[model samples]
Target: MRRGGDWKRGTVERPVGAPVFDPTDERGEETERATSASPRLSSTLLQRGKSDAADAEAICEAASRPKLRKNFVPIKSPEQQGAQMLARVRNQFIGRRTQLANSIRGYAAEFSFTAPRGLSRLQQLLIDIRDDTTVPNLAKELVEALAIELARVHDQIAKLDKKLMQLHRSNEMSRRLAAIPGVGPIGATLLSIKVVDARGFKSARNFAAWLGLTPKNHSTAGKNRLGVITRAGDGMLRTVLVAGATAVIADMRRRGSRPWSWLKDMIARKPPKLVAIALANKLARIAWKLMVSGERYRPASAVPMPTPT
Candidate 1:
């Protein structure tokens, strides 16, 4: 109805087909539900993405890692680590033994009693000195002290030997390697430990190079000059190899067998030290081939003869 020319108020109405709930109240409810679910969804998605990425990266890294030929294998085992430790211990004992022997000799020389050259002979001399009434009391006391020190070093060496023997029995490779000529318990144990894997080397030459057996080079202007072995690898192994070679060469000479022709010539031309080093290098190469091929040592004659030239 109109009153004094004023129009009547129209009715308030919502949009057609809209929900019947209050707009402000419905919006608040929807926001609360979304806020609660958002964190969990995001976290789940992030974790899934991270895992997938990590898997892909791992696969790629593995593919990128360096690999040898198909037949090559890497040494990766606790047994190898154990073998290395034993070698180190044995080497240490040997060094200590040498030091003690030298010290005993030097100490005895102060009293005008020259110690014998050999270890066993030196020990006997020390005992005789201790028992001799002719020696002054002060000299006798000093000799006794040196003897005690020598005994202590020997005990340590004995313990190391026991440990090495135990390892030799436990390790199949060590036992087999010991069967090779010139490779005693110490050599076998050290070799087994020091050589992590045969597969790491492509050939026998490569293995010998690792032991620093290959000749060193210093060449210029197309003139090739060679020097002594680099001696780059395990010092203990190198020392053992040299000592073994010296023994072999000595035995060969004693037996009057044809010495390695080169060695024979060198003995005639060079000093004893140089010849020993040369033989050591040859021995190292021989050892590498034997170990790599799992073959036994054969004398030159045992090898088949070449056809007539």
Candidate 2:
């Protein structure tokens, strides 16, 4: 016998002509029919089986998730770290040395013992004050302590400088950057480390932006406005660039060359500070291009001129 157009079960199956009960028949009957007819519903059973298999597979995969591997870049070696640490310590010492000298000078000024304003004059001033009978014993003691601290600071800086020079000799990248004018040992070392991948930037403009040398923008509606530099990148690098630019500017002036006519024009028109910052921005861009291209810096005249119209 057959039921719902198929044969099933050991008991006599209901005939196809037998009264077909609606699924929405009395609650108990519907439930009984649904339970009894479940196995006969081959399509639904297969679908449910497939769903269970899929869920089990998903759970197993989740439970056995692959271990994640760390991909951290290699850290600096112990020697490099040591060198950097020494350099930092030396910088701090130099700062302390300056502070000590300044404090002594201030103290001397209070006693009408004015010393010339410069580090070179510091030792002489200290000596003069120490030898003077007019200075109180307490003041002399303070001066002596400051002098000792200054000497210690100088010693530390000197030691660090020697270590830095050794490192610079071993570092080819540092040496290459150092070849650039106005970039000394400190500048070269810092630039090499700070700019790990010069090619990370696509263009010189992008490099300049990375160094926060790009002009800031403010726009509303269809109008656009440009202002000072964004100052959004490595502050230390930016500072070094400014110092380098200032040195370059001074050197150009001494040589009777208008190296950065744009800066000179800006200085004539705008504030000195603005002109300085602009020059720094130009310097940073120039440095970026030089590093990325592995090219030597050439003055404007040395650079090939475009074909004239």
Candidate 3:
């Protein structure tokens, strides 16, 4: 078995007593796993060799390995898939809205009008485009059409956001994870639905590494070296977590929240972006603990501190 784009739709039930192994194809670990499972060398391991038959043989061989069964990708429930689809659609609309906004701004700038930075200002830009007799009517009509589309997209996004909030409120795990700083409805629900079993990870560090928040190791001959994040799994999850961390950092900077002392100290030593990644990594761990222990997050201080609600 392989976890590709179609696996969610095309996957069939595993036969009785048949082993399953989902090749993490995007990570290029498919052939490696095959090699570990069988005596026959994978086509990927051979120089100047490739064929569909060879690939099938490799998969057949790998399926016989007793250790391969644990690597199967978790089957997501319809609700989980729905939530993920909602988030994805919301993200798509957000990106489209941004593109439309920038297009409007760029058009306005050409006419010596500089719109203020904010989505709320797009309406004013539309007004300016329509009323500015100095501007051509054709350009005005096109900009108006784009503005209409943007408004519709915004409305759709708002509806999806409400749905996501509903999900966050309804799911106990999502609520518990949401109690952690830098873990909001989006982040919490994403993890709650996407991660089938948090205990499958041996430790918090493993969870963070799976999320690709930890630094990459490149040590040799007793010389230790580390690099940027490996970015191994679920790029969208990592992105949202980092975004939540960024919001937390901004709030800490504005309100001087004491609960974020660790973030502040890290900022003093490292760059703000680096601090955000570090905070996201820690948030991943906290989320894992909440999932495994089935406990709500308890803030360290009595003071009312501001974070994602």
Over 4 Å off in model 2, which ranges? 1-87, 221-228, 300-309
Which one wins by lDDT: 1 or 2? 2
Best by TM-score: 3
What tens-digit string does per-residue lDDT give for candidate 3 at 1-309? 344422332323343333434434565443323222222323333344567665656555455554543344554445665777787777888899899889888988898877788998777777777878999888888888888888888898889889888888999999888887778878998888778778878899988998999989999999999999999888888999999999988997799665465665678899888988998998898888889989878876312344655
Q: Estimate TM-scores for all models.
A: 0.65, 0.64, 0.77
For candidate 2, give the lDDT.
0.63
Across 1-309, the per-residue lDDT of candidate 1 in tens digits comes to 233333233212223332222112323432111001112222323424556465445333333334412122232345565556666776776777788778777777776677557788886778777877877999788767777877887888788788878887887767766655456767877777777666667776676676777779999999999988888666888788778777777887798766656677778998776787777666656666666777766756322323433
Off by over 4 Å in 3: 1-53, 60-71, 259-261, 301-309
Evaluate residue 259 in candidate 1 and report its C-alpha lDDT on the 0 to 100 scale. Answer: 66
Error of 3 at 180 (Å): 0.9
Query: Which window of ten consecutive residues has the lowest lDDT sum in model 2?
Result: 66-75
Q: What number of clashing residue pairs does each candidate have, in the order they appear? A: 0, 0, 0
Q: In terms of TM-score, how similar is model 1 to the real structure?
A: 0.65
